[model samples]
Target: MWIFGYGSLIWKVDFPFEEKILGFVKGFDRRFYQYSTDHRGTPENPGRTVTIIPAKEDSRVYGIAYKIRDSDIEDVVSHLDFREKDGYERKSVMFYPISSDQKPFEITIYIANQDNINYAGYADLKDIAKQVVKSVGPSGPNIDYVFNLADAMRTLFPSVKDNHLFELERNVSALLNESSIRKST
Candidate 1:
């Protein structure tokens, strides 16, 4: 079985896999529409996180795909299930690798749909940035999550464009800079 990681999973992989491929899945647009109360914020104030929305037009979200060893499938799946229990549900999608010689294959993705209780559902980049800047949870600062995922994407797949994600990162960076400037002054 295979698993896809488009967000934090890109930078933080706790599970063991036989192989990893950098690729993309179609028909979805990554957006900061999910609230991360468990990982990046408290229940009182939630942090913004990426959750793929079904796009009207064909869209591609680039990320890493891990091929689980047959023996480790059970353990890996169980770990992911608990980690993504907040509002995410597992769905299978085709992953297209960057290499030309590789063929597309089905992989499991965790998606937090609008119906989920933790769903923040569509907010502007600045608003999302503000939330991310101030929130922190058991996992640590929300800002780190945004920065890490953004950096990983740019470093791993420079050609692919994820406007929402990149724009959010820019907005968050600006907010942080402004905050530091204000503090210094």
Candidate 2:
């Protein structure tokens, strides 16, 4: 079995994998439209998280695909399911490995269902940044998640364009800077 990770999972894969490949999936856009009430925020103060929004055109969402060893499949799935219990559901997506030598394959990814109550839906970058700036949960601060993801993506796929992610990152940085200056004064 293979596991596809696009957001935090891209940077943080707690599970052991036999092999890991950098890849991109088409027909979806990674959007900060899901509300995280577990790993990122509380029920009373939900934080923004990423979920794939189906796109009409062929869009490439860069990520990593991890090949799960047969022996570790059950344990990995269990851990992933618990980590993604809030509004996420496991869905299959075809991943195109960056290395052409490797064939593209399908893997399961945890995505937030549109009908999920915790789905934050569409919001501009500034508004999303505003919410992320002040939210924290069991895993950690919400802003840290965004910052880590952005940095990870840039480091991994240096030439890829993830506008929504980069824009939100810029806004969040500005917000943090403003807050810091205010505190110092």
**Candidate 2, residues 23-69: lDDT per residue as tens digits?**
99899999999999888889999999898888866898899999999
Predictions in order: lDDT: 0.91, 0.92
Write model 1 residue lDDT over 115-180, tens digit each, in one string.
889999987789989999999999999999989998999899988777888888899999989999
TM-scores for all candidates: the values are: 0.97, 0.97
Q: How far is each candidate from the true structure, as Cα RMSD in Å? A: 0.9, 1.0
What local lDDT does model 1 show for residue 142? 93
Flag regions of model 1 displaced more than 4 Å.
none
For candidate 1, the lDDT comes to 0.91
Give candidate 1's root-mean-square deviation (CA, Å). 0.9
